[model samples]
Target chain A: MEKKYVIGIDLGGTKISGALATVEGDIISQYTVPTKASEGELPVLGRIIETIEKVLEEGKAVVEEVKSIGIGSPGPLDTKTGVIITTPNLPFKNFKLVQPIVEKFGIPTYLDNDANAAAIGEYVFGAGKGTENMVFITVSTGIGGGAIINGKAFRGSTSNALEVGHMTLEQDGPICGCGNHGCAEALASGTAIGKRAKEAVTQGLKTSLANYENPGSYEVFQEAAKGDDVAKEILDKALTYLGICVGNVITSFDPEMVIIGGGVSQGGAVVFDKVKEVVKERCFETLAENCKIVPAGLGTDAGVKGAVALAILESK
Target chain B: MEKKYVIGIDLGGTKISGALATVEGDIISQYTVPTKASEGELPVLGRIIETIEKVLEEGKAVVEEVKSIGIGSPGPLDTKTGVIITTPNLPFKNFKLVQPIVEKFGIPTYLDNDANAAAIGEYVFGAGKGTENMVFITVSTGIGGGAIINGKAFRGSTSNALEVGHMTLEQDGPICGCGNHGCAEALASGTAIGKRAKEAVTQGLKTSLANYENPGSYEVFQEAAKGDDVAKEILDKALTYLGICVGNVITSFDPEMVIIGGGVSQGGAVVFDKVKEVVKERCFETLAENCKIVPAGLGTDAGVKGAVALAILESK
Candidate 1:
């Protein structure tokens, strides 16, 4: 039978989402399940397999009809060996994630880090479509990125390229989770913004932030929009650092476009405006003028689509 | 006739060097001439043409035996259009440097920025000969770089990727020649080191540097080696920033190797040690450990070889 179907699994810490889609990316059926990652490796793996089965059943698709399976997971994992090396949220520790899947399904399987998968998704089906070079950045609890160079994923020597978040933006700024000082993630990520807000409230600074039990970037954006000076100041500082990170990316990569996504990017005009201004200030005029920085085109359902994109592109 | 030869031209502000080489990168004949750029565009173009002819005659090779001709020059230039948009050292402004040469020789010609040409040279014939992914950085009066991705020159959308020098290392640090503050070039380049020593001497700081008519990085390196406090302090600070820049490159690109070239890199152990230290401190342990950081392999004749590499690689 002609292979017209593919399976895409977004393996996250809290949940696993799977989709059965046409080769052209039209989703026929999808399923989601709680990961219960604390249950250890085998149980979580079973849940992921279950997710695949449910999607296939709902879509009325057989294993022979599927071209391939693609898994997008949190990583420090080995993409070449198809192993989930070790990740904080997941239970896998150098687990051979792809081997079992491919054996069970009797189909080719591919696995990549979530950031890289998302970048491929953007390059193939979202905002970065048609561009040979683009960067996809996610500014959530932490900053992470992936790059498409010459129309293919640039995985560097060890499949760890485009670790833009860990880049040192300031020589002596705040200490980062990576044990480095002045990393972009330490200064600009959603977690960083929340930590700063928490520090301000704890210091007895006068602000509306104290009113919230816990103010993350979402609450800060809300308060800033309502004219809270403390909130506005915090947003301004964090976004400025974010802008510097984006600017540095432009200076380093000179890609055709940079697509920003994730929690912090949801702040709308404030985030993009600051990033654009700083990029122009930091990069060459021609590069700044020619490259476009915009929000991600994919929406809330981007996770499965990104996995699907990984499957589609890698299969080709 | 067998295509056994190629011509390479290194077009610099003060002088232009040309080479005729076998397809295997063995230089058969070479010649050099003053650029005389102030005389106007055509004169310089004529000199380039004349140099190519001389190399061919000296090598006892004809146009039929040459596969292609390559030119490496100072830029902001269009590699796609064969146009030099403008450069500080060269007198070309939107001048088509490749067209007339191709017309005269009846052979394919390629033009690229010097940094990129050097990168290609390293990838093909120097320290990075076997590296599939490597970054070539030249830290001189200013810092500039180029990258080899998957064994090809990975110039981005505008043919201007790998501008690692301009990445912000300090948010409110010294202003750069590009009018930005805290660029890697502003903080750690040979020019920056020289500027710092000059300022200290001018301010009448107690140091042996004041004994000299003019002080530069070479002088600072000498004094620091002899245990001059001011010079040592300057070297320490500048090298730290240079380390940070290299660390940032490691974080961003995660290439197999980063080969540092140009004037400042010649400071020997002091420069390499400081850069390695900072890179380890600021980068991921796996990346810092895995990525090789070393001095460039090609020496004084690197310019002509770089141009030749550009021709050889592009022709394929």
Candidate 2:
């Protein structure tokens, strides 16, 4: 029997990434193209298509060898219909994402929320590997994640599951990008970290962070490591809120593992250790001991590899 | 195929409720016996067995026709091994619950957390019927819950998933029964409502609630509806926190339906309507519309029915 392959695409506002992988998920080749999203949907789609074509050519693979193509996008998308409902950064509304890809390559195509794809990546090959239930959370610019339930991405009735970061933490807390008050994303994400740091500076809290015009989450982490009290307080508060979200996920989904990814988690043990400490303290004792909180194993490859996992798993 | 039957037992702190139900979840007969749990493990176990036998006898059923027995108990129990792992109210520690039933009947036995069984009962035959994923939460004297994913109970690796009430809503909030601060149970449960009301009366707040020696959650709800400011404030706060938890569950699990049961919810449309209003205001825009927050349909039978659900669903 001949080996089968699939194409996985990670569509983002900044870049379009594509990979050709075997059925077992070994990447054979990869390619990427800048997504000038400001140029709008047509150009972004062109870049996505070009990126896939380049990956297929470089891999020396034909459409017949590929079972299907999968795309993971930042979205509140309709995965069953492969339609992009409305994304925060992308210039699209009710855009037919799967039909175009299927028509272009003559292979079946599937689409899912990028976080869900990343979760599949972790579940199949990363930290969540071998766990029947796992939650993959990325504490990046904004907290975002997806859950793998019973060894599959748990899409709800509308294909939207694991919208974790928007859960309310403080009823009267700060407003979130989603126009809600006290969402986990609004109170604990990297964006929230930066916002809090800026607020401290604006409040004239004598902190070393004020040296920069505007500090990102990385700078805040660095300053906190340097023992800057205000920065330390801000980082601690953010991680504490994040820890509450993790605890909520623990009680809510009760996954076997929770894999932390995204840029903010790249702060490594500093953030993971603190968040785990809080979760262990706050979560129910019966469930907390059985759950392992770990960092994502796939790093930058999660999106592409997760897309591949989605293709391989959902194709059937 | 011959008609099959099963036995479901709800082992609560004060009573053991048993039901004889058909394979399709139709209850044929029910029996209840006082637990007198302080009588130690052997007596309680005897009570559980007697209750099941009584249920079968009253239904005019024979043990030969019974496929299996399922029990739902207040836990920290090992559902996998069918061991009671030292519940808060029960004197038993490391007690074998499933083996005794199996030994007595020469039939298979399944044991699960009471909340988990109730969730299955709701998903299979109650308000959550016809939905692939549902969350059942009971906000009574204490808050507790279970989740059903893909039409089955989502027991975690240790058979302890969906500890919804224990998730922290406030880091520095009141201490919960689980020894954590600001758990949803600590902040929003019926106990919490009563505590807040009593505290208000102690603080000498002028309100109609002070007429009662100790106002409970039911009284608070009653006075709130009657336009008592203090009672209204206390109930509204508890319900608001409950709404936040509901919203969190929506974003975390993205279930098709959220079924609220327990005495507090039995306040009928008054509490459910307020809680739904808060959930709609707090949940993610994409998911809020898709999830229906409704009252549990099984009512008092949820526990026994859920136990029945566990017996039938897990036996296969």
Candidate 3:
């Protein structure tokens, strides 16, 4: 008997990723297309469709066995209604993508927040496979998260649950895009790191980072690794905020494990080691001892694969 | 057929509340004793035992009918191993209450932090009934919290989850007992409210609160309600901190609902109305629209009843 497959799409500001995968979550074929978001939602969505078509054409056998399609995108979204209310990175407002995809494919389609999909992906195929309850945090330009309870994504009463980055780590600290003061994202996100590095340079602190006319957080991390004091200070502050955020998650969710992903996490052991140390030092010993913080295994493919997982689960 | 019963003991610094309840959570009889914790653990344990016996006797239930006993106390505690590691309010360290209770009744006994028990109680019988995921927060002298997921108390990896008060709301705002700066508890707890009020008076802020040589949070609330400017200022500041804390919970946990309990909450609609307004204003609009902030329904009985709920679940 031929096994069934699902199509997963991850829509981002600059690119659209599409994949054909088995019902078991194994990727069979994948494709990508540039998303000219400046050209607006219609053009970018057309590119998404083009990418999906390309993936399906390449995975003809899997496409013939395909049951459904799923899409993961940045949110404020209405997962139940399958509408993207307003994604910060995308030039779309209340875009109804699910019905359009379902109409195009003549099969069921599901939509979820990117973070939520990534969490489901991790739970189904990554570090959280064995845990009954877990939380997945993605620390990129902005931090975001999703929770899984009893092996299912926990989307609160609405699909807007798990805004992990917006939680206040300091009340009177830096301002976040969300208009909050001292949010974890405001203190520890890649943007925050970059901003801090720039401030240090502007404040006349001597640093090798002065070499970059406009340095980003990755550059700061690289400089810190090379023993630059200003870069180290920025990295330490980010790590402290990250640790506090992790500790707060432990105190609030009581999940068996926490899986972390995202761009800044690409710093690898440096980020993980410091995060673990701070979480342990700050949270209650019992919680600190029991909760393991692990890096996400699926890497960049997590979102698309998670979308595929959602398709399979919803179809079943 | 005769139904089995359980004994639930809520041990606090000032009072010991014990109840004999059916496995379905119906209270047959209850008793209270002075904890007099300053007198030490042994004496307190004797009082707890006496209260349990009195409750059972009053209910006309024999020891054989009781399936198990559950104790809810302040922590740090070892719920997995059933030991009270240390309770700031109850002069106890490494106290093994579960073994003694099990030995006396010849039935298994369970121990949990009071906040955890209260959360379970709310989940099973009070505000959070029928919800698979929720957070219960008690705003008393200090804030405390418990998380419930999939119909069970979420004890984290080590059974010390839900330390909501310790999460940082302000990084450099105030000193906390946990040696942290600007913890939610340090910024918004009842203690914080009183401390801030006293500080205002010491700083020569003109107010009717000066009528009391030493004013507690309740007195401040009373004064604020009666139109005292200084009291209003202090109350507003406390509410701002609390609102931020509430927003933090929404951002962090994304639960369907949050139940607020404890003495400060008993200030009636004033506290709830203000907290709700500020939390909605401050949190992510999507999250704020989805989550409900409700007052705790079980009132003061939440702790003991929560213990009963835990015992019944464990016994089953």
Candidate 4:
């Protein structure tokens, strides 16, 4: 019999979501459960496994029918060795996340960083579909990215290419989590925007944001849209940094498209317009003209769908 | 007879050099002729063909014995269409360079930007020989680069990737020849270094560099070596910017090696040391550790040899 199904697990800090899908990516069954990360490594691992089993049972599918399993998790992990080398949200520490699953299900498995999975997802089914080369940048609390090179996910020597968040934009700007100063993440990430806004609120800046006890990028975007001078100023500064980051990426990669995703991209035109304007001003006219910068197409179910896309891609 | 030979042409403003070589890249015969670009497009085209004929005759090889012809020239050209799209030094304007050669010789032909050809040369036979992923940066009058991704030259959508010279480092840096401000080329190219020294001399800065009639990077390096503080400071700033440019490349590509080539790199220890130090300071530790940053191994013949490598690699 032909293999007709695949399983995808999206391991997040709070929830473990699993999907049983056809080779075409239609989800037949899904299950979700708490990660209970505080319960430590094995328990969290057990929960991931339990969700997979639940999706299989609910879909009335056999492990033999599933072509492969793909798991998407936060990383700094080794994809080739399948070790979660200690991500912040997940409890796994140098844990062999794929071996036990392969043993239990007797199926081929693939593991990748969430950003890479998301890039593959976009390449296979989202806004980046049909692009020979593209970059997916997710700008939420942090800025992260992945590249689709020659129509495939490109993992560099250390399985860690497209670390755009760490690209230094300002030589003497804010410190980044990676111990570098002036990184794109340090200057333009959602966290950076929120921090700047909170500081302004605390400093008694004349803005409507002072209404919130504690404000972040969400409130700052809201206030900016409502005509707050301080809020507008903060978004302009942060978004310019974001634009420079995108411009630099375009200069370096010269990809067909740049797909912006994550919480910040949800701000829509305000975000896209500024990035396009800056890219036009900074990049070579040829590069700027040839490339399209747009928002990610994957919605709330992006994580799980990304994992499914990863399975289908890697399996092929 | 078995096809066991290739031809390489290094196209330049004043000279055209062609080589007939073994499939393995040993030069069997070579020829050089003045470009006489002032004679216009067809005359320059005829000169290139003449060089090819000269090399073939000198090598005592027939067309049937040659596998392919490769030409390396100044770019913004279309490798896909074999068109030389108006280069500064070359008289060709949207000229179809490869088709004529292929028609005359009845052999496959390839054309690539000089930088991309040089990168393939390094990947095949120079410092980047063993790297699966590497970036080649040549910091001469301008800074240009090429990337080898997964052991292949990766030209993005428009076949014009790795335009690193234009990457913005300073938001308000000195204007570049491209009319952009704060490009890596504007801040760190050998031309930029020379321009800075000229400005210093014109300003009557207290430095030995002022002793030269028209001071440039060579004089600056010389004076800096003699302990001229002004020259040393200029070098420090320029090399720092170069380092930041390289650091950002490492951060974005995560390649196994970064090969620095071209005229400025001949400064040796001063260039390498500062770039290495900055990369360590600015890039993620893991990326820095995994990537080897080194000067290019190819010497005077890199251009022609690169054309040879381009023929062999692309034909394969």
Tens-digit lDDT string for candidate 1 (B136-157): 9999999999999888898888
How do all the candidates rank in terms of lDDT, highest first?
4, 1, 2, 3
* Candidate 2 residue-wise lDDT at A29: 97
Question: For model 4, what is the alpha-carbon lDDT of residue B154?
Answer: 86
Docking class of 2: medium
Q: Which candidate is the best by DockQ?
A: 1
lDDT of 4 by residue, A61-149 (tens): 98879998989999988989888898877666798989988888788888999999899888888999888899999999999999999
| Residue ranges of candidate 2 with Cα displaced over 4 Å | A1-3, A38-43, B1-3
* Docking quality level of the chain pair in candidate 1: high
Q: List pairs with backbone clashes in candidate 4.
A: none
Tell me the RMSD of model 4 versus the true structure: 1.2
- Candidate 3 C-alpha lDDT tens digits along A84-196: 99877788998888877777867678899999999988888888888877999999889999988766777876676678898877767788998877888989999999999
DockQ of every model listed?
Answer: 0.83, 0.72, 0.54, 0.79
TM-score per model over all chains:
0.98, 0.96, 0.85, 0.98
Per-residue lDDT of candidate 1, residues A152-254 (tens digit): 8878888788888998887888999999988899999999999889999999999999999998989899999999999999999989899889988888898
- What does candidate 2 score on TM? 0.96
Per residue, candidate 2 scores C-alpha lDDT tens digits across B37-78 of 988989988988898889889999989899888899988888
Per-model lDDT:
0.91, 0.86, 0.84, 0.91
* Model 2 error, position A298 (Å): 1.6
